[model samples]
Each structure stands twice: as C-alpha cells, then as structure tokens.
Target: MELQQMRYVVAIAETNSFTRAAERCLVAQSALSHQIARLERELGAKLFERTSRRVRLTPAGAAFLPAARQCLDAAERAAAQAAAAVGEVRGRLAVGLIPTVAAVDVPGALRDFRQKYPHVRIGLCVGASDDLVEQVREGALEVAFLGLPTTVVPKGVNTYELARDRHVAVVAPDHPLAEESTVDLRRLSAEVFVDMPAGTAGRIQSDLAFSAAGLSRDVAFEVTSADYMARLVGEGLGIALLPSAYVPRLTGVTTIEVIDAPSRAEYVIWSRTVCTPAASAFLAILGISTGPGTPDRGPVPGSSVRVAAE
Candidate 1:
C-alpha cells in the first residue's frame, strides 16, 4: 500500500492502541484507523487484531513492521544525502587555471581551503585562458582562473575579479636592457623576442601594446607555457613579455618594467548554472581580496592588485 499507510500500520503496532498511536503521530484516531484499514485491505492481510482494551499485531504485521520502518528510514536518509550533496561543502571540485595563476599563490590558497574542507576533492587543469574558458563552458570544469580580454565567457558563466597581475619584460641578467628600471616601448621593438603562442591572452595583450605604440615585434622563439618562457629568458634565448607573477624561479633572467602598457586585470570565472560544494568553497577563498585591481610596480616591474570577491 501507500508509504503513509505503512507508517500508520507501524505506528499502531508500536503503540498497541489506535487512540494512543494517533496521538503519538499527531493525527486523528479516525484518520489513522482508516489508513491502517486501507493498508490491510490492499495487502490482503490483517495488520492488527483489535479489542476494546488493546490492539495487538497480527502474524503478518509482526513480519512486515520492521521492513516498513526500514523503508521509511531509507527514504529519509536518501533525501538528507541529496540535500547534503547540494548544500554542503563536501564533494569533488574540478577547476581550470591559466598559466599565470598556476605560477601565483593559488596552491597556497587551495591548501588553506583543503584544511577547512578536507572531504572535498580538488581537481586542477592548467591551460591557456581560451582553453580554460571552453572547458568551463562545456562543463568539463566547474570554474577556472582565466586570463581575459579575448575570451568570450559563455552566456551561462559568471566572472569575479580576483587580482590583476601586470605584464613585464624578462631578459637575461647581462642583457643591455636588464639594468634599466623601466624600458620605453621603442627600446623593445627591434629586439628578438620570445613570445607566447598566438591564442593566449598574454600574446594578445603583448600584440596590442606593441601595436598601440606604433612598433612591430621581432620573433625569436615561441612557447606556450610561462614556465618555459622564463627558462628560455634565463638561458638568454631572447627577451619575452609575460605576466609579472608567472615569472617563477628565475635563475639568470631579469624582469624589466614596462613603462607604457598597463590596465591588465586577472579574474576568476565560473558557470552560473550550478557548482559543486568544493567549487563554491574554493571560490569563497579566492574572493577574499574583493577590492579594485592593484597597480603595477617593482624594481623590475611587478605590481599585484588584490581584489576581494563580492
């Protein structure tokens, strides 16, 4: 019979009195009796043997009461688990990161988040901004730290400003431009440069800056990863322009300031459709600096603006 009918049968059997069971269940005695009677008629078995003084369980009722209780319990537990999966921060989070963020303090931030929510599974995929955006839009990733400008964030995705890390020129320490506090755009024009591949946000920004200053680029080497770019610069392969923070572990490379091009901002973007508990929790950690983009500065030219997420 109906789950409610089963509940009524179990309640009456436990109390041994329809009146007491109705009171325990917060229902009218007549209603409870009707439900239990309906259950017995549907099952073709009497659930209870009743007298004016007491209600006793029939043989079939004794056999079925525990099963009925278990069924109800299972239903309730399933509902609770579904809610926990939706609202609690205890599940898998798949995230995509750009080259610049992989070099930044995201690992530290994730460590902190893991300490707070150890049960959450964190999966990371590192790629260019365009690729990461595509992953997020396609639901391959829940969210991502992506380089912007040319990326078309799909309609169902949302964006948050994290921090803006500016671009700088990295050269061999012994290069003529290495000692310069800040090089003019004209000085970089004729130099053979190690550049990011054409599709990346850094490449687009670099191209725009050169074009805006009425200069043309001289290509020496091309690489996709920022880490590789740094190594190439360290080896004196050629000068390269890259995000300031992405320059990690520079041995012989010196990062020089770019005096002309600014306005670079980095953001964390995600889907608005839905997010796992782990994804939401990580977003909370990344959004802590919810202010404006930090201005660029440094001995070479590294400035980070810490923006808090709203």
Candidate 2:
C-alpha cells in the first residue's frame, strides 16, 4: 500500500533481480525483500516468484506492475506540478530521438532550452522509431521524436506533427538512375537495394510502397546507420530508399526524388500523462500546445506534406 513498496515492486520487476533492484532503490537487499514480503502479505498474493538464479514476477505481480508505475508517475507529476506552480522548470528530462529526425534542429533546440532553464538536465536516447515509441509509452522517456507511418498513430499517446519528408532514392553518382531527376519505383525493382534493417520506419514505408506498386526490390545490403547506408551506396554496393533528410551529402552518392514513393511523417509523441515542466518547455519551443485537449497541428507552413500511408 505504501508508495515505497510500489517502487520496490516496480524496480524488482524491471530489473528481474532483487539484488539489482535493491541497489537501484539504494536500499539493503534484506530490507527490500522484507518490504516486498509485507506488501505481498497485505495483498494476500505473492508478487514475485523467487529462485536461486533469478527473480520473476508472478501473474499477480504482472497485473500489479502497470498500476504501480501509474501510481509512481502520478506522484512524480504531482511534485513536478508543485514545482511548476512556482515557475520552476528544473528537472531531468529524458527525450528520445530516432535516427532519421533531421527536420527538427535538435542541437539548436537543446542549446536554447539549456540557456533558458539552466538547472534542467537533459538526457537523449537514440533508437529506431518503434523502440522510441515503446519507450515513451512505458514512461522511460518523457517525449520522443518519431518517424511514423502517415496513416497509423499509436494509441494512448499524443503526437504533434513536426515534419514530413518524401522518401528518395540514393545511388552511386555513376549509376544510370542517378542522372534522372526523378525515377519510378518500378524501375529500381531489379536494382540491389541497400536499406535499414526491417522494422524501421523508412524500411517499412519502402516495403509497403513497393508492395503497393507490385514490385519487389532485391535487398542486397541491410545496415542500421544512415551514414553507412550512404557509404554502401557510394561504393556501388546497391541503391537505397531513405527519407530525404537522412540522405548523407557524400561525394559518390546521388539522391533522386522517387516519383511515387511514400512519405514519412515525423512526430513528437508523448504519453497523455501529466506533462513535466521541462517537457512543456521543450514542446513550447517547438510551437506546440501542451494542453490535454489540444488537437494535432496537422502540417504547418514550411513542413513537407505527408502522403497517405500505404
């Protein structure tokens, strides 16, 4: 029932090790176990199934975990709200970024945010769009810049469209398709495609576009980094479909607009939970409203128009 007990349960569930959880909670192993036992007794069910090698949550624990996190988040938000009431925006803010987030001048934004709130700490996490979305959903990150499909938005999250850029084709400068101002997706169906690993926003869009066009690309090289993909294309390894912003300015590579390619939409997404002061300040800098009832600013001037998702 105690908030500290909820904290212990969450920590133990996340780490899956009572020892590590105790370390994370900055408490002794025995005392942490004692508190958890008390909680289980009060609830009349065991929360964790402990073994010599590992600690895992029981079904009861699994059901209780999300509620525990919600309680903790509510408490944290209450504290943050009290601090915000005094016009203070000083706290740690965890922000997530996907690899293809080029539309937002992240460095410039961070610099301005730091200048305005000198005491607020910023932590940056970079990952694939799906991973970043999941992190935001799980409360691991306060906000994330995600490259999502135009038609689909995750549930229980608020998203503000930041920018949308068309997917383009990149190839070696000497490649035949490089000279063309715009090439059709069917023309490159036979060409070797260098792409990010499956499940990435760009890759998913590319796959869907090709499928929609009744074409299949020969994916010869799969890389996780945009820079590496550009390098691979520069070396004549293969061609790649990438967000225009992610195409590197490399000497041997040439970027061409794809005639019928799908566009990827970039969004700043966060859970609908109460906003932290730092998150609010960052959103304000991006010209977004942080109110709960605020609607999505579909596409602003200077932002690329998004195509319907395939």
Using lDDT as the measure, which candidate wins?
2
Q: For model 2, how does the per-residue alpha-carbon lDDT over 121-150 read when each residue is reduced to its tens digit?
A: 789988888888788877788889888767
**Tens-digit per-residue lDDT, 94-191, candidate 1:** 87887666323677777878898887777888888777777777667877776654333334567664545567788989888888999866888878
Model 1 residue 99 CA deviation in Å: 1.8
RMSD of 2: 4.6
Which parts of model 1 are misplaced by more than 4 Å? 1-87, 102-104, 150-156, 288-310
Each prediction's TM-score versus the true structure: 0.63, 0.76
Which pairs of residues collide in candidate 1? 287-309, 289-307, 289-308, 290-307, 290-308, 290-309, 291-307, 291-308, 294-305
Off by over 4 Å in 2: 90-92, 118-123, 127-141, 149-156, 173-182, 196-200, 208-214, 221-225, 249-252, 259-261, 292-310
